[model samples]
Target chain A: MSYRKAYLAAPLAALLPVQAAAQGIDETINTIFADYTGWYVSLIFADLPGTNFSWIALWLVVAALVFTFYFGAIQLRGFTHSIALVKGDYSDPDDAGEVSHFQALATALSGTVGLGNIAGVAVAVGIGGPGATFWMIVAGLFGMATKFTECTLGVKYRNEYPDGRVSGGPMYYMTKGFSERGLPGGKIFAILFCIFTILGALGGGNMFQANQAHAQLSGVLGEYPGWITGLLLAGVTFIVIVGGIKSIAQVTEKVVPFMGIFYVIVSVIILLMNFDMIGWAFGQIFMGAFTGLGVLGGFTGALIQGFRRAAFSNEAGIGSAAIAHSAVRTKEPVTEGYVALLEPFIDTVVICTMTALVIVITGVLNIDPETGLYVWNSEAGRISTEGEVAGVELTSAAYARAFSWFPAMLAIAVVLFAFSTMISWSYYGLKAWTYLLGEGAAKETTFKVIFCLFIIIGASANLGPVIDFSDAMLFSMAVVNVIALYFLMPIVKRELESYVSRLRSGEIKRFKS
Target chain B: MSSEVFVVAYEGAQDDPGVLGYAMQRAAVEGATLLLVHVLEWSPYSFLTPEELEERHGRRAKEIERARSDVTGPALDKVKAAGIEAECVIRYGNVVELVVEEAGKAGAGMIFVGRSGSQSVAARVFGSVPMGLAQISPVPLVIVP
Candidate 1:
């Protein structure tokens, strides 16, 4: 990487000191980002004493489990109805929510279904081996309950302005739901959630997206000054974000879903092409989940990686989906919950599993012949994947094995995924920002300008600290959001019970059979 | 018992008033009740951001109101003045699809659609609402000049 930089960066250095100055700033930002964010990161992701399990992960899992039982497994019971809702089958003209089920689902899926499904899955499989796929699926299934619970509360407590604007999220529910129940501390938790969401929008949603888009672009275009990519991305994003192009959102709402379907179709084609290996691949996945398949720690290692990546990819318990789902048009808030539950399932259970199966079936992870363990890349200090690649590159390489031209397609998909995610997060971050700073044109523009600048920073800077800080902030959102969920879930339960009874008794009007 | 219905697909652009006027005359002659169906041009499948989705219900309602009051209301009044009972319908969806659907629902005998002025490349390739109606409307579709 350094040699490529030296070779590619010579002209920019000789022409001017601009690139040099950017590098210096990158180092300073990285250091400061790491220093200030390290403690918070460790605190959220820390392993429980004498166990590899993280309290954060456990908190999310237990909440999902409890919600699953409390609502009598609403995820399973309402799964078909959720599909029906999205298809406009049960949609009533008088019961319009803000957005359609499809739009709300698309918006939330765009946020969760980005590089994490591609890159994060690769990393999990690299470290935990094939067994991780099984656990990831399990985690994603339970996560549906979590998404259902929180989004129901989101709509129940959402603030709809008379002018037709709507703002509802974890922050609103945290305060409003708690206050309604006569509980204190909702104010503080809500405030903390907003803070985390703002920082998270900057780091995970904006910068990380910019950063990976840069990496993919540079890989395809040959090593170029990162700032060039950053500037181009930032400029385009500013036009779309600040310019308020409703058409772009419409285009993405169409395109992102198209891309997702395309990705899965290709995955299906690859699996069919290697038709004989499908069963064996499932065997490896199932066996690995329990026995750990000679990977470092066995069952526990696979379980941890599966849970962590599923959480990262689907964000079921994070409460961010509530923000997106709350915007859905539904008279019954629980109907949105039914719709929101499909997000984690689509993201983790379906998409992530496709990437995982492709990696395992394509024989991407290098295995030690004698020990049958995943080979560690001593130089890269990670598990050696096919062609000694890792992260998103490994997923790309695995797909390339089926179609040599797939890497280029994957690159395009990555950038589109990043772009859609950034736009969505800009909204998420803006909502939080306006909540804290108050609504005004100047305030909104200020946050937007800063967001666009961070896009450039994310694209231009080294990923080490930027990604680290963002991932931490993103998880930190979960820390506050989950606490709110615990308190607010009963509210969701009441909604679910009423909605279900009405639905069964033919009280909830269905416009379509 | 002269309660026959005539469906007029109203775009309400420059050429639309002329087409609607013709429909009103035809309805008056036939003693048919006029059903002015104005479609707001919406696709249910289009994706929306959080902000867009949040304001969608309000925007859609506003769109419906504007189409009804501003576009169809005057036409309906003019037709009523011409001794033809008229009702206005505002809907959201493809112009051709909604026109046909509303026509069937209202039991209209004929449909009138205006030829939009701009015949740009996109309009040519995608086909105009009148062109679509010519291909698909169950009732007789008249393309007004």
Candidate 2:
């Protein structure tokens, strides 16, 4: 039987009642089983065909190139400036806004740096082989332009409520930017963008984060029920989120740096242990990126997968990070824009490269002697057909192989990393929900509770479909957000010029003291 | 009866000192007492060493007193030049809480704050601390951009 037919038939046949079973038994069995099966079937079927994106990746490559050129290669030109912002060279207490430049960068990074870096990179390497890492770095480099444009617009169009609060993101740019440009459908597009953003938050920012955390917890603490893990995560997340951005920032400012440093240090140690294979791994990455193994499909597939994972990881084009960047304290929006360009670099280029290197350097993708195709033994704790590995298990394996008895330590790191990410994303999703639902206490409470509940749901329930749907929602948001950004480019240019003028005129002097 | 007004500037405003002058002028015109308050939002780590904390606090106190002297000196000069009475008050806490408390302690009828320019209304509403205080402040708050 065909895959689809067999998939449908098995579920239907399982629902068929035994001859001895009563009508009540049939009803109870069907009701309980039907809902789950239906959800699963839909999830598997809903997988989009073109999502693999063989040709679109090339288009993305072209767009990245054009954006870099049009922006005067802001990524390279402003690299020093980006570093300065992080180092607090220009921070001024007199600056009007919310958080510091560093805090704003951390907040935005907290949103972008999550499971997409971990699981998504693993999937790419699994399907496309090690070569995908090279294209990923390429995509990450070009993505800085996209990041700059969206963030510049985010600040330019941000709304300061009469109450002195700031609300900015694609929602503002979509409406105000387009209206200024005389677009007929500005409000409609803005409303649609808000809706998609809210959906994306629920799916990508909330559910997916919970799902991954749940997976990791389940993997490490298999004895504990998944629902319990979800409950614990939900409780901790609620405390941080209820305090809003200030609290979120405080937590992430500490958590992100620690986790980022911790992950990098561990990856470096692992790489050092396998010092000999480093050269070979780099060689494979370069060769596999361009040359298909006896076919065009492999080469292109690797390229697409690499780009896809990198795009998803850094979120340079997605515009969600802009919402966070818009909160930065600065009279000059372009200052924050420059700060934002560093996000893709840290998230995709630095952290993700480390993860990719660990996986590839470990020889996780060994060539089968019989098939001559790269495959891992399912029993050997490698990438399975089901794509299930203990959260950080493969990385842990590599580390453990290098330094015996390190899996436990690595497990602790994984849990902490996942925990920090979940808490950060909860804030992002909550803000998006607040944008949609308004700031009513009832609405805020309901969204927070529901969001917390999802952590439990994500932990206990099988989240394969839920995460897939969330991933789609996140990328779909990028589609709408990036389009809005194109229309708002003029505002970005205006802001940049105005800020640069002020800088040159010394109206806004660097904080020398 | 004229109402009192207090203007507080954080760390970065010390350079211009014009904001202090401006606050004094507004107070003199209204026959209100001008209190210039500067707050130090120091980190918790600063308290780890008692000696360090004392030294830091001493330096911070000196800075506040200097800023207070500068404000009241020029402010009183301007007030006396215009034939008005003015005073300067200095204290510290959380920025928002300190401002609110000092506004009450000084019994100022109104408060004036500098505005960070060129932001949309929504950005201010969701993210700005001044905006948040304005929403719920017991007294009228003026944002000077």
Candidate 3:
């Protein structure tokens, strides 16, 4: 308890300096982040030779395409069975000696379904136009195969300690899966993956979430210093992560699923309210996706933005979900893979699509009436909008059109989503940290403290450099993880083949309807 | 061999256990066996945090162990002390369904359920275990007040 007081005091103590410098601190931090991380961010997101497309975006999309083919389009073929598995129809109590994966899937969904669905889609549709939504669904569909492959490897190579604890992710699979295949550089790959995972957890997973939460709040509560929100969020986050408070974390986890459902319901109601405009929206999406409809970079621009945001949104090839899904209780690793594939579908295909549709239907993006093209704001480098808003602000504005009170509700949702994402990523970062440094209480506490501190940094900093750096780190993980997936995919194929055969042959029994 | 096995829906130590007493008397009279069934209410679809999901396996094992020791184990000793053949089954799921399934599997001649007579809204709306068993039990259901 004394240590708890010390931990609580640490953030408050640090806040004084932050508040003292709050005037120019935002610009200072943003500039510093950009200066330090800009080279790597530029390199990772560098456009392909002779193209405006990011090679990393292509990296993820290509890997997903390969997985989609290599698994014989398993995302589509296994769709019905994945639903059944999630519904607990295939779970046998005798076989489920441990907890089932339904809850694991739900937890993973909460982690991915947050700001990505809300804000990321807005960015995509705002820049890429409605057509970005179409490619987003396509990417999401293909990304399911990537999730299936990685999560299967996640479960197969996972380390089970004697204390009934388990740990797994791309790092484990890279080392073990590669060693078994006599591949060189397996350890190097594992180390690289761990490094990227830690940074990604801090950047995309922690800071990006906090930054957006602050922005959403500022939009609603009038202008305020970002550090004020940052300190408050960091303090509460410290209590939950460092203080070992399960009740608060549990309450957030419970509410997140309902929030996801409520978001979908609200989006559906808004869509129904403009039911007549539905066909026109899809037409815009279809046209914008192919022709880009005079939008910047034309067809390629829409494709790149759609693919980039979808990769960010669903996290198909990113491999973070693999770490979460690996902890599921299952003897058959393929079952968890089946359960994992549903994540991208739910996050990108279903929820992200809902957001994209609402944004389009709400008339947030300014359209040239005669040309029927999204008005490209040359200065802003995205579509000209009603308030020149982008990201989560654009989303809040769109939803506010339908319901005057929606912005306030969206603010709360943003905060909750940000908190949940931070908590989830703290675990992810801890896992990667321990993977690199080995596990211990002192080591874990250090990571947790650093993680809480970054929440303040993320909250206080401007979005430009923080998002760029985070996206770069996250994509770097995919660069390592997808390479491992290529080598280890055969093992997943074997597992999937055996399971599907047994399933069809009736050797695998279903316990309930 | 006495084929009669009376399924006692053991409601843990919280209830009166008058149903267990009634089942014990009936089993003794018929020289029958008492099958104690304790179903811990659980759902696989319940939401959990990542830490909770990670440690769920360990927690579930502890829960089953606690239920056996704190609830079923004492009831089994009570039934054995009464000089009647008995066995106990513990599982995690919907109480009524698992109890009925266990009863049918054990070739139960009757099911003895304790009615706490709870007026709680949840019980009234969702129906208590006794009410559920009364509807779905394959064997004769006796609600002991």
Candidate 4:
């Protein structure tokens, strides 16, 4: 073996013994914990049957669909109103809130519109084939309805501090809404949502953002000790995030638009460069989506892969965006709700489509005719034993092949995208933390410090299992948020009617300054 | 002896503004003075001189006068027919701080301000200003939504 291979093998070999030792301890601890909590574990685990559909995912989809139906497909009916909200057509400076509608959307977009669009889409296409993109778009469309409902609830239940500051999100809505409805276990559900949101803010929001940033930095800068990137990101994040949402919004309004436009422009260039293959590439997507082509275990597996990745990317039903959207400066909850609908459309429909097209057009994969397993291109010098290329590397390679020096540019974009995402998520997590711990300087400082530390942790360590668990926790939040929205649909309906009446009667138009 | 109350009216929203102007005119009719304070919130950073600042505040004051005319025009004419005296005052600073200070300066017993509604629906449901003013203001604040 070459020296590089020998070097790579050493640490992995060294880990074996450590893993074995740790496994022994883990097994013992598991035995003790399992004995102590046997019934609880059984109850939780028993819910999961190894079926094709994930019960959690299914529940989320059903919730999203039901919300879409219950709200009279407000996502569709309110599309024009959403546009007006973004345009600030109805905006008044004297309104009781912080930030503009556009700023709120951008802030929320920055949180969801990160590496998941790039790497997550790549993984989906890689595993589920092209048809998955269709399902993802469908899911995203339904997700807009979910976003609308939850964001409305977020604004509805928000608490404004004495200093004219705002505090909101699923935690407030879940508890306050439920209590108003006189539901039992409202407080418990609220507490649970808070706990899950905080965990999500840490795992998905904080660590995942850090991990992606570190990856892009390492990829571009050629692995010059992970802590260097970690420290730099942590410091920059601390400065920006210390100022809170106002600071975060100001930055995102600039960053999200620039980065989003830059990526879209690059994707357009790549598509134009390979303009002829666009037809064939789309064909493969359609064909692979349904037939599964050579993929092992047939169409079912591909469908699962696509749905999972799409859900991960858009976070439509997850309700995390509602936390960001609640701070909008509108009097009409449905107005912000209308604005929230644009999130999934922008995130999933526009951005994810760009990613899926790029990966498909690149033609990197060689599928087995019968089994559909990807064939290694050993002679092409791009194949690795890792079974799959990392999402960032795959995207980088695609760009590099398209424009020769483009990988370096992509690496820079990735880092910026990831860093922006981390800062936004840090805010989300901190807000969630404040909701749970109360708004003290010490608690706030502690959350920020811990969040920053995770940048280093995510950069320096493997986060495979951590990200998986984090993802699960994030989806679990959707469960609670959607349930609350369902019970509170009547309130949303009332608000919708009132807003529409005002709009139709020209009450909104007649208001003079 | 009765205490005086000041009502601040925005340029538009006729129904509410009319009622507010009528109320203020009635308060003056009842032998209590009415002071209408409007602050431009035009920052010093936006202008070259205190003169320029005054100019901007003047224009805003005229706009407030137009609003005052609309409110106290036909409505207050009727109130004057019923015998009420009303005055309008304009100042500059932060809206909340100026509103509070002017109320104190005028020695007003109570302040009546109209809620402009929120720029977005979220702001309305959460009740931002009412929640905020309730926390700090020394005097009672009644927010009309």
Per-candidate interface C-alpha RMSD?
A: 2.7, 13.2, 1.7, 13.7
Candidate 1 lDDT over A2-112, as tens digits, reads 565467656555635576776676677667767877787788778899987877768777877887888888888889999998988876543432367887888789888
Q: Candidate 2: where are CA atoms >4 Å away?
A: A1-63, A96-98, A223-225, A242-253, A292-296, A369-373, A376-391, A404-406, A461-463, A501-508, B1-39, B42-145
Q: Give a tens-digit lDDT track for model 2, residues B6-112.
A: 65443344413445556656776777766555555542211111111113324544656675666445545655576555555454435566677777766777766
Identify the runs in model 3 with alpha carbons over 4 angstroms from their true place: A1-21, A95-97
Off by over 4 Å in 4: A1-50, A93-98, A242-253, A368-388, A510-513, B1-145
Tell me how candidate 4 scores on lDDT.
Answer: 0.65
Ranking by TM-score: 3, 1, 2, 4
Q: How high is each candidate's TM-score?
A: 0.92, 0.69, 0.95, 0.69
The prediction achieving the highest TM-score against the true structure is 3
User: What's the lDDT for residue A460 in model 3?
Assistant: 82
lDDT of 3 by residue, A1-513 (tens): 245435544555555655557848877777787788899999998998898888888888889999999999999989888899888888878534465778779988878889989988988888888889999999999999999999999999988877677788888998999998898888999889889989998998999999999989878765566877888898998999999987888999989888889999999999999999999999989999999976798888889889988888778878889888888877789999999999999999999999999999999999899988889999988999999999999999999999988987898899999899888889888888998999899999999999988888888888777778878988999998999999999999999999989988999988777
| Candidate order, lDDT descending | 3, 1, 4, 2
Give lDDT tens digits, candidate 2, residues A312-428: 788777778777777655777888889899999999899888888988777655565685455643463233322344334555555555665565555455555556655545555
Docking class of 2: incorrect
Identify the superior model by lDDT, candidate 3 or candidate 4: 3
lDDT (Cα, 0-100) at A301 in candidate 1 = 82
Worst 10 residues of 4 chain B by lDDT: B45-54
